[model samples]
Target: MTAVRPWDAFTSAEAEVRAMVADPRWQGLSLHDRAHVLAVRILVTPDGDRWLFGAHARWHLHDPADGRWHPAPPPRGTRARQGRHPSAELPLDVIPDGPDFLAEPGSTQAFIGPDVSERLTEQLRVLLRAAGRKSELEYPLTAFGEIFASDVPSTVAAVWGAIMWCAYAPAFDGNERLITVFGEYLRRPLPGDEWVRWLPTPPLVDLVTLVTERARAGRSRAALRLAAVMADTAQILLSDTRFRPRALALLTMVEPVLREPTLDAGLDDDEAVRRAWLERCPARLCRALMGETDREAHFSHAVYDLVEALQFARDPRQAAATFLADLSDSRGALPARLDHRLRLAYEELDRAGLTGTSAGESTEPDGFPVPGRVLTMPAPVTEVAPPDRASAAAVLGAAYATGLAWGGLTGAKVPERGLAGQAALVRRLIHERDDDHF
Candidate 1:
């Protein structure tokens, strides 16, 4: 057994943890127990600044010299107060009476505050001293690094929001107001610094998880609001290359809830409702994935996944089918996918003889052929041969003339060339038509 000294004990708790793990006494302890002990030691430190418990509380420290545990006095400048309210204190609550910390409001403070940082360096040292401790040691150290590197104010608010919604009930009577404030903060542009860079990932994941759990448990409004906040934050963070992929993954996970069929009953129309819900999904996904050097290859992966799922839907496929169909109809092509389904749809149309061109021929360049008798805005003056560009232009011009004449654009006495002249004629006609019988 290695000898443990006061310097070694105070320098790295993680090192001490590793030494303990290697010790015969700790060999039988489960990983959870190990984590619990590490967490308790972490909480006992003076980090996590939320509630101030005066420094200098006596605690056990393992002595390396004799390979045995010893009573260590608290570090210098530390003095315990007699009447401090333990509940209101900060770091102390982090090491609660139980093994696992509850998702209580005050608990996060211990994990995120300054006191933890001081002890983490020491903790890591201790954990590194033992076998099979490297992996576990790194986890809390990384967390400590993230906490220390985070924007304290924003992180605190986000953590507080998570606690409010998840751990505490009656989450503030003015929860809506609080949400609005946080939403505004989310909308604000953050700087492209290390602190802001780490800001979104942890908080966003926490919010999404909390909202999903609540929504699953039947809190619809809270879930919706949480999702909205998530979407908004995602929009802001999409600019950051490092965080986009994970953000997109979380957004995709919650998309089904937003698109739930039952959620559509309150909308103005089914199509409008569905489009509004889906539009944001792609916009946010695209915005986040586009131009990302690491993630560019998977930029359209989400859209393709949704398309494939829609094509194979076994039940209530109508909703997904209708969404893709409307997108194709209005947008000319599926925004992300490679257009396999589009080709199939066109082939089906051609097979039905709706399109004059055979499937075997190159009837149209890329999209569906324009209808022949739709009173094309500019009618052709003569029969156009195949691929006759000039002739096609003339035909279109004639169609435009015919449309104009049918609408009285040329027949009116007003000037006839420019848009201004056409507008004057249309205005006179509108007054005359309304004044007249028909």
Candidate 2:
């Protein structure tokens, strides 16, 4: 296979950036900098578009008048090039600083990360509104169950929209679509025999062991994929008294993957946020479902990282201390819809009783006292249990069935079993678990 040149990866976008840079307005500029432009971004503001070229660890704004490579204002509370993720195309603080930019999904230099999907958010809110119209209808679990079980066309569409949202962030919220999908799947009415046939006798213990061993053997990516299966089934694993221990054990295995340098490269590097356990077990587990090298998912990871950071703060006042120090400036550039999303996150967290610090409460060593119970990360165990192939196959079958439902709704082509049959199908798709196109 021929390699894709970075410039060729997004031909039209590159052409547009090139055209902007080559305009006669920049003719008077004298440039001696030999460094190649590694990334290109266009910030859309009410005044019009301002083009930015990133090179040599700094972003230079293109000035039409003088064409000098003048420094753009540094992001809030951070020095130039300091605290950026190792693989980040641009600084995290700068991402939420303007209206959302279009990214050509697969390009490494794509300028924007995924913002909260407005359509999905709107659709989901409508569903919640209907569910809450009656005082007897309890929100979240009861509402989610009703929606998931309904075959009503509009409700189904809402469910799929939420599913796409979750697949994007995998776990954008601790109690949103991620919980709805997996929780509904677990709570769906099924015959005793059907339940027995689908899950193993010991629930997901065998599969959990398989994932743990894979993590220990340094097959982190593969382990990540398997752990996602458990994540999808987490409503059962975490909620059921029978399997909570196994869920905790699975959590123990993938916790390191959360803090893995490669994964953390997509997260906030601010020590205050870092010390607050921004990436929790639920968030990381669902995130592992995303593609390894997918730019779309990587950007979504970046957005989710910010959401997690926002969650870390006890309140808006607390957030202003660090990541939100320049909130006023950042919000000025944020699109109205995107601004609404952040506000919604705050509302949801507040409703869950998850946000806020008590008066005069002493802070933890990290200076940020975690608001809720923190699950202890367990020590690694040495004994190995052979994976039950039967259980793995059953879980794959469940996942395949869900894929088929989605396929039926979208009328999109899905992968078929090849000559190697079920195993081949599993091998083909396990890596691309949350890839919509796949």
- In candidate 1 the C-alpha lDDT for residue 194 amounts to 13
Per-residue alpha-carbon lDDT of candidate 2 for residues 97-132, written as tens digits (9 for 90 to 100): 111122112111100112223444444445444433
The CA lDDT at 100 in model 1 is 18
lDDT of each structure? 0.28, 0.29
| Per-candidate clashes, comma-separated | 34, 0
Across 1-438, the per-residue lDDT of candidate 1 in tens digits comes to: 998654432335434544554466654765455445554443233431111111111232222233222222223232222222223222331222221111111111101101112232233223223211223211111122233222222322333333222210111111122222333224242212211111121222344343444445455664554454444443333332223443454455445555662453354533444344434444223322222211222212222222322222221122122222212122333222223333344334434433222111111123423333111111112111212222222222222222222122112221112122111112122111111111
TM-score of each: 0.18, 0.21
Measured by lDDT, the strongest candidate is 2
Deviation in Å, model 1, residue 300 alpha carbon: 24
Per-candidate RMSD, Å: 33.1, 23.5
Candidate number achieving the greatest TM-score relative to the actual structure: 2
